[model samples]
Target: MSAPTATARRSRTRWFALGAVAVAGAAFVAISVSGIGDNLVYYWGPKELRAAGDKAVGATIRLGGQVAPGSIKPGDGVSNLEFDVTDGTALVHVVATGVPPQLFRDRIGVVVEGTMTRGGTFEGHRLLVSHDNKYRAPADKNVDIKTLMRSTAGLEER
Candidate 1:
């Protein structure tokens, strides 16, 4: 064939470049979506957990709810804890082996990450305490703000 025209070569080059860019963009999106899917942790309350039934067995999930009143118990090990998490509608038994955070207590919100067992108990590997966003005034009746500010002024001067 005769030598290709400059315009024809430029046209082919532009199409090839566009195709490469499109392929790169598609690959980037595919990778990003897959990564997000693998790392996403769906939070489930007691009712949702119960509704999940057998489908949730052995799947890692985040259980979010309040620790049931009077359900906290000492587990087999020193750091192990057993409690029931409830959302007022349903409850799930949780067995966690770790150092519980200082805020962890019954009647308080918590999110536990672990897998649900076939027996319907959550085998928690991590524990997170959830606190309300509302702020409350301190109840120290004897301490005056002026006196406290005066005491801290010396430290600030230094």
Candidate 2:
């Protein structure tokens, strides 16, 4: 081929490669934007969810609340147990038929990870025990307040 024609062909190939790269990049961006909503997580309170009306149907969610006072009914002779948890303003009835930790009790702080059923009941997948402010350290029962505060920063003043 002539010198000028050979150089022109090489330049054309470079531009073609650049165009291919740009198209691939745009396709990747479009796919990422389209899938954004699918990865979103929704946090719900018992009251806010109940108020959602028909929108709450078949949606996966996480609910936070305290175990209702005197509502925990441990199994009579089986692992199955029933309880009610409240978010102070809203209450949700939970049915957990598994072995419960000793910390599980009425009026204690608790979190249940579950999904809401069509019948309005929560089926727990895992149970969490909440702690109170009065936690005592078993290692050092005799540590004075002043020393303990000095050891752990930000806690001494409180």
Each candidate: what lDDT?
A: 0.77, 0.66
Task: Tell me the tens digit of each residue's lDDT in model 2 across 16-111.
Answer: 999999999988887778785345533455676578656765665665566676798877665558888765678888877567778776655565
- TM-scores of all predicted structures: 0.61, 0.52
RMSD of 2: 10.0
- Writing each residue's lDDT as its tens digit, candidate 1 over 1-158 gives 34578778989999999999999999999878768644454578788889989988887888888788789998777566999988777999999989888977767778889999998889999998876443335896765543332221212232
Per-candidate alpha-carbon RMSD to the true structure: 12.4, 10.0
Task: Please tell me which predicted candidate would have the highest lDDT against the true structure.
Answer: 1
Q: Model 1 misses residue 119 by how many Å?
A: 1.0
